[model samples]
Target chain A: MARQKMGGFNAGSMADIAFLLLIFFLVTTTMDTDSGISRKLPPMPEKDQEKSNDKIKERNVFVVLINKNNQLLVEGEPMDVRLLKDKAKEFIDNPANNPKLPEKKITDIDGKYFGHTYFVSKGVISLQNDRGTSYGTYIQVQNELAAAYNELRNGLAMRTFGEKYKELSESKQKLIKKVFPQRISEAEPKNVGGGK
Target chain B: MSKFRTKKDKGTPPISTASLPDIVFMLLFFFMVSTTMRQQDLKIRVHVPAASEIQKLEKKSLVSYIYVGSPLQQYQKIFGTEPRIQLNDAFATTNDIRDYITSEREARDEKEVPYMTTSLKVDEYTKMGVVTDIKQALRKCNALKINYSTRMLSSE
Candidate 1:
């Protein structure tokens, strides 16, 4: 037999094969940017302590309850979610600036030290949800509440710093945060199966 | 002068496709580097909700995922159809969260420990009870930075 020969395999088809696979992945995979409703969670409870109502005055409290039936109860009255942001803003700004409202204007001395002391810490948003509340309604309410705070901060940031809230310097951002702190105190979930 | 110029090889050699495979290979390697294959075989069904205000979790490594959804048909025999929380690969319960977070924190780069966040991949139809429990667990551990993993609503 003649000396054995080692033959080379043609590599020209390699690019065509790779292109086919590339096309497959290009069509099949979805390059999605993950996003969400960002909110700061409350600290853990030390114990099963009953929440005291005396600390936060009635005017400063914006109570929002979402029940199993997907209905919203603001303070004590039933309300549509579309109006939540405005109502929250009104309560926070208290545009009425009623003396009974717990909001306090910044004193010149306080204003000098702190750039934007719009409202005091008494402004609390207590969100309570049922165990059965669907995540959709829960998130929608959370988004609206967060939006309320964001709008407040943005408005003040603009007036005080002449910049949007997110665009402000770090120190300025801290000052803004002190004024419009997000006090969304989430109570323990209550009633789990109405999960529609 | 034209006759003396020796006809300048008009054929032009087919644009030298010798580098075609090399270019395609380069693209293939790029996609290979950038693409992350399914991190794990999802044993559960997760349909995250959509919202108007959204923010991307900055670093994938700094965030630990908590998947909450019902088991798939294959896992139904073991985990049942009820909505459950998953940590890494195994089907876990609310109680497992603390230890899981700790271990995951320990497994990361030492300096990155402080920036750890819990990304809750919760299904839209799921009840708030489980998500709340997980949140509370995260809070108790002081792993409070949370990313409620959500998709953007197609509308502005």
Candidate 2:
């Protein structure tokens, strides 16, 4: 009787096996990341709650309407989409202290703007779109509105903290947000015009 | 000339492939970790609109996707060219959203139910009527947190 020793297992094919697995993953892998405009829809109104009409002043509400033709009507006036951000920013900030823009409430935020009462805009962007409006146009309008708020917050953060809003400490960011809160109120869509 | 001739004769000593597997394994691990496998085959064509102000959807495990788009060419005969909602792998109507939400909620940890987000990956060209219906359905089901899934638009 003779005992036989096993030769070293061939690892020459190991590379081939790994290559196969690598190719499989490559085929199945989806590299695109998910990103988007996050929003919180208002909770369904109770039967009684729907009847209660807490009126918002006309000056404080910046009405943005999009029609089926993708036309932009801002505050009852037709405006170009390119001009929406600046218009929104002006409505929110009201740097000139214009009486026509949204009224600002003086609040002591107790931060870098300490002791000084900062005027927080009490503005609400009311967005209403026709049912037949294209999703692309709707998203574009939403983007512009969001960008307006972001720029305002960024400007405030830079002025107070000398940094971007995203770079600031949580509390500091909160203060800036308190000054320029994102208050986009989406109204129920209406069939203002016809489209498929 | 003599040095060059000797080096050529040795022929680079077969260029050691001992680490070939290691290299391939490294690449394999990278792909495995950095990307997610395609979860469902798309039944419709969805070209998400581009937006300048966008936030990355965080906590992917707590996110569920609802696709809204017109049927692809092959599906047009059966599903028609009209835009429709696709939940999971099957075509669904707005009415089916509640059940879908319920099932999706039940699939996750109870504590995480509140944190769950419904991402709407709707086509850009689709009319808002269908999207509005989806939103209303989601609102009724109390799935308030939503992300309008979009790509980044270059700032002009």
**Model 1, span A1-196: residue lDDT tens:** 2333544456678779878877666655446555786666767666888887767667778899999878999979999998999988777767667765556656322457453433454577889999888887898888888788889999988887788998988988887777777888888787654453
lDDT: which candidate is best? 2
* Model 2 lDDT tens row, B1-156: 998898889755766677899999999999999999897999999999999788998899999999999999999999999999999999998889999999999999999999999999999999999999999999999999999999988764
Q: Best by TM-score, which number?
A: 2
**Cα deviation of B13, candidate 2, in Å:** 5.7
After superposition, the stretches of candidate 2 with alpha carbons farther than 4 Å from their true spots are A1-8, A111-116, B1-15
What level of docking quality does candidate 2 show? medium
Q: What's the lDDT for residue B18 in model 2?
A: 72
Q: lDDT value for candidate 1?
A: 0.79
DockQ measured for candidate 2:
0.75
lDDT tens digits by residue: candidate 2, A1-196: 2334565566789999999999999999899899999999999998766575778888899999999999999999999998999999999999998999999888888845744687888889999999999999999999999999999999878877799999999988887778888999999999968664
Using Cα atoms, each model's DockQ against the true complex is: 0.45, 0.75
lDDT for model 2, please: 0.92
Computed on alpha carbons, the lDDT of every model, listed in order, comes to: 0.79, 0.92
TM-score of each: 0.80, 0.92
